[model samples]
Target: DAGITQSPRYKITETGRQVTLMCHQTWSHSYMFWYRQDLGHGLRLIYYSAAADITDKGEVPDGYVVSRSKTENFPLTLESATRSQTSVYFCASMGVAGDNEQFFGPGTRLTVL
Candidate 1:
């Protein structure tokens, strides 16, 4: 797995339930990010981690949480899923911010009912 992989390529869940989307990369990149893509919103960041044990919130972190205890994995968890959260989730990674050319994983399409 030299590139990133996202699990549950498609998901359907009820509102108010907890769900987690997995991401894994083998490149050992320093920067990992989670973003949600919607019609008008292009792509909004949900969370990011610079390195193991170093995580931060991005533009749209509400209803979503992320952890990067390992360089190869960055999973996003939805504390309480909502209809508004239904969107395609993409995981990306780069070596650093300035020169980071993001490599995106095949997105996970989530539907909250």
Candidate 2:
């Protein structure tokens, strides 16, 4: 089922540029998450969706946006890219039960200069 997939595994952009990262999952989980991994910050949640059309901001949501209109897809957009946003972004999902551990995608590495 390829459990989860992320597009443009690698990306590079200049400051102030706009970028979108795509994520897809075959499990059709009701919960999905977006996280970023960096040297100092480690892995921090950026946004999460409880279900289709129900989303919320996470620990670090500045300059970033997300949407989940389908149970299997969640896309993240960076309105204005910045060097600090250069990090590996991961998409994860969990069943609707709300108690299961999450399954993460391969991740997308992005760099802003």
Candidate 3:
């Protein structure tokens, strides 16, 4: 496949647990991003990676972390899951920031109890 894909389309976990969501892309895009969509908030960036071994924090990167060890894969980890973190996580990739369009994965719905 040439598009991006996310694993564990749905997940349920208790609060204070650690969970990792997987994201894979076949385009070998240079830019990978993690975002969470809540009810009212459209989309908030959690983390983004420019390339392999290069990662940066975004607007809402407090409880979430990301790594890009490979250009085609970027994984997001929740250090300590909370009820407030229960939201749909979306993974996206783009060739370049200003010159390319972003492609989003299906998304992973996480529920924290």
lDDT of each prediction vs. the true structure? 0.94, 0.94, 0.94
Local accuracy of candidate 3 as per-residue lDDT tens digits, 1-113: 66999998999999999999999999888999999999999999999998899999999999888888789999999989999999999999999756788999999999999
Worst 10 residues of 1 by lDDT: 93-102
The true-versus-predicted C-alpha distance at residue 44 of model 3, in Å, is 0.3
For model 1, state the Cα shift of residue 108 in Å: 0.2
TM-score of every model? 0.95, 0.95, 0.95
Instruction: Give lDDT tens digits, candidate 2, residues 1-113.
Output: 57999998999999999999999999878889999999878899999999999999999999999998898999999999999999999999999665787999999999999
Report the poorest 10 consecutive residues by lDDT, candidate 3. 94-103
Question: Model 2 Cα displacement at 35 (Å)?
Answer: 0.3
What lDDT is reached at residue 69 by model 1? 82
lDDT of 1 at 80: 97
Weakest 10 consecutive residues of candidate 2 by summed lDDT: 93-102
Quality of model 3 by C-alpha lDDT: 0.94
Per-model clash counts, in order, read 0, 0, 0
